[model samples]
Target chain A: MSNARRIIVINPNSTPEVTSAMRDALDDRFLCLDIPEGPATIVTDRDVAEAGPRVAALAAAQEAPLAVIVACFSDPGVAETRAAVPCPVIGIQEAGVAAALALAPRFGIIALSELPIARHRVRLERMGMLERLADEVGLSGVSAYAAGHDPAVYDELLAAGRRLIASGAGAIVLGCGGFGPRRAVLQAALGVPIVDPVLAAAGVALSVTGGQR
Target chain B: MSNARRIIVINPNSTPEVTSAMRDALDDRFLCLDIPEGPATIVTDRDVAEAGPRVAALAAAQEAPLAVIVACFSDPGVAETRAAVPCPVIGIQEAGVAAALALAPRFGIIALSELPIARHRVRLERMGMLERLADEVGLSGVSAYAAGHDPAVYDELLAAGRRLIASGAGAIVLGCGGFGPRRAVLQAALGVPIVDPVLAAAGVALSVTGGQR
Candidate 1:
């Protein structure tokens, strides 16, 4: 059997919705691990990256196999976390990308702001997936919950999607956490695949970890 | 700004190559979290989906915040994990689909085997992303490494990809860990966006959890 003794989930953002959404996404998938008594935890501090080392140090004291997930879109302490922990560490973005590649040949990214394109590019390169990226389209200075505030964001999303599809992208990844609820509307309009990182990461984690407890 | 203290990464399979690839994918670009110190760990072994909850229970003991990632494709312990931990947990497949939706409009999942199609579909449903799916094409009964073991398998992959694309798939995902090294080659032939789950998951993880640790 797999020996993942413990897991820690860190939400870098202060927003409870994102954290809760992430939590809800993984609810009830690993029933077997519970019967055997496994462990999992969630951290809600926006400052996890800098403090990550201290956390890892504490987790190491448990003397069991552990896995850590940087739960924010920014993945602050991923490297430091890796260096601090002897076991493997993963970020949801990394896990999401890996899982996406497993299912799709090409994919696109939807961002909340236009400026993050550079950041997204850098991320793809770091992950060695630049070549596979068809495009990175921004939602044009909107918050994750922009759709709720402005119904027009949906139209903007659709228009942006057309541009990405024209650019030869086959799949779309919703960059903002707020877009999760809009997936159905967008997917129907785009008539293509749309990926929400939260959901994608949750699924891949389950598969790779195989419902560890 | 975030206060997550720990994170866990669980790998469902025993293969070291997969683990190494996962590690390499997140080697750099962890600074998204905006924190300097982060902690992480990787778990290997354990099969079937039952092992996740046991692992998560162990993480709940820490006083700090935590994030958990299931590194396998099946998303083994997500359900139990959520119940076990007070923090958020993510899976690679879940993260992957989210990222893919951001980039592509329609994506096809070219998986390693047919047996997992139903499971993959179920995962898609859980994420509320079933509509984004164009197709779930299996690679004609092949293991991830089978392509490398024999050239014929590579040809089969190519053939499967072509069929998927023709069937209205705009992008592809490399569904297995064995396909890690072949992403570039597949992209070259497909001329469309492809989602590498590992890469996507890592990137999204970094973005969500805060980058550059």
Candidate 2:
């Protein structure tokens, strides 16, 4: 396959573990790039602001693949990256919500912490989809790092998922990219469609580019 | 390019004018197929019900292209077609709605007539997205046939688009495939995102299959 057909997924944060998890979820369908200079995890507005330029710069420096997926739920620098790159640039947050809308009408989010819930609310508000949102449940203090290594976080997610379902969400979206690996388990337990944003981005990229590789 | 990578867009209704309009909209990106035996237009539940098997059978008999887009906004036989085919099958309504959700929070539909509004409402309700709909405006008496031949139909569509915007729709979806050719004009005039479902289906198909021909 030509390099032009390749899809590049960039993790704005410097977490190799999260990058690896994303790569595993994609199963070698695309190239996965991690920014080693970014914070270990983006948990605050400051972290997101700091990572935005790095993500846009990295995307700008690439050789223009078929599509670029900014693999963060906050969609760090997505607009800037789109301005920087010639190919389509997809934000995982937007892709996840889009995928959820395709499968069902109302969707709920399971976030890593209260910070993302607030951030997500702002993002949804800007998109004019806050009305479509059923509920957003957060793990309170759970960090992506702890969630990845901790099995107990799944229970918390399940509890949150139940609450979202109770609130009338027909589908659930994992609000953080680090929650990618736990998607299948949560979907099975919750008995509803669970959207993994990275996968959703990959799907969108494949559809837009028409590159089967 | 392999034939397997080709995308076939099937118009469930047997309207050559609508099919030609769809082909023009796509600019020959995919193979456009029209069902010779289907109704002239899918307006009523009976028309949709009658077209289902034909669409499914046509889809099933194809040589398994990378993806298939059922070009009708009503998405008559999408599920049956999916069951019959191994590759991805996209419904224009689903694709359009998904694309709309990606760009904006709430979407308004500009339908061919009042008949499709009820059908669309039921479909949206089934998807669990009825609440996300800002409104659906119909060009009361405008048929696909009349819309294609008459430049005057654009006035009705423009009026409907403005009504949707006034009703707080952040985006507008051209509810019929025949409206495909008018997308740019409407978007320019309305100053909001307008989703042409056929193009949306093509985009979704390309993303899912990764086959750019």
Candidate 3:
């Protein structure tokens, strides 16, 4: 059992590499948890649907932390998790989008795959922020596991970022939790504010937790 | 001279009441500075324009703090202040809008007067978030300085909030710094999320300062 001040960051996927990368990107004080029962990567709506309940259950079972961060960019079961917990439950996707909006008028997303783009669109539409999206560009060959291990994916990310800028994005949002560590590098390469969803979630979680860990 | 980790929160208006309200709302760790040369309240474009250079000058004169928060909702001289300082300079309006967007899709403003509504519209348009606005409801007889002392303003705020919700706002943003203390109360009364611009600026400032202050 973690202390009451600990923040639980839940990565809703089975890939340990992705979870490890997220933990590295987050503040050292937080407790990072990954759902072992989830799919290796959430590439489709079916994967999201399947992972949702498991993530929510894990979130509900945790003793009260300062807050809970749903580390996946799709924000698996965030509303359900929030209803089950007394403390704040923030979705990385929501935090990222909010950060991007603060930095720029229009924001574009660099997504891991074509399937997640549709899911991202639905979330934005539900938030009534579809109009603020310049575009969402996906790299077809990327997966959360491969994104950490492969140097080639950076090139794909760069290319997608350029296309998003060309499409009129004033800022860029890395649309996957695995992209957290690459935020500073991508922002420098792209010459725009780049929001990493995991970090954004941590920022919001920390704010809600009264600036404590 | 303040310490390097100190954050300077500037209430551009000259009113001591509004400034005191802002200081109380902010984290105790910050150093709040009030611009005594400006008008009593910034209710119009003329007032914002008048206060801009004074606010910018005050911001420029500060020895580098961790960050600077322009506490006025109109965010007078934010761009100029950012250019003048090496550290981050955040505006309450931008922070409030971002926080509202993070919590909900469509956000409405409870503004002080009709004059600020037009200025707020311009800022929203510049951010390309005009479409995300459900509406900007104003309290005809209210001023920032008066809002704190008058218990009657709460009724007007409630009316404005209900109208904003009727107009399709999923969340409410308090467009004046003086309304900061009433956020939780208003949220409970309105049955929705309420974003207080001053606290929102503090949250963003803390995030930009790497959560140190």
Cα TM-score per model: 0.45, 0.64, 0.78
Report the lDDT tens digits of candidate 2 across residue range A113-177: 88778889998777656777999988967766656567889889889999999999977888887
Candidate 2 overall lDDT versus native = 0.76
- Candidates by TM-score, descending order: 3, 2, 1
- Best model number under TM-score: 3
Candidate 3 chain A, poorest ten consecutive residues by summed lDDT: A204-213
- Please name the candidate that would achieve the greatest DockQ relative to the true structure: 3
DockQ of each: 0.03, 0.15, 0.26
Q: Which ten residues in a row are the worst by lDDT in model 1 chain A?
A: A30-39
- Kindly report which residue stretches of model 1 are placed more than 4 angstroms away from their true locations once superposed: A1-213, B1-7, B28-47, B54-66, B144-152
RMSD of each: 18.7, 7.2, 4.2
Higher-scoring candidate on DockQ, 1 or 2: 2
The value of fnat for model 3 is 0.17
Q: For residues B142-197, what per-residue lDDT tens digits would candidate 3 score against the true structure?
A: 87877666778888888999999999987788888878657767776887667777
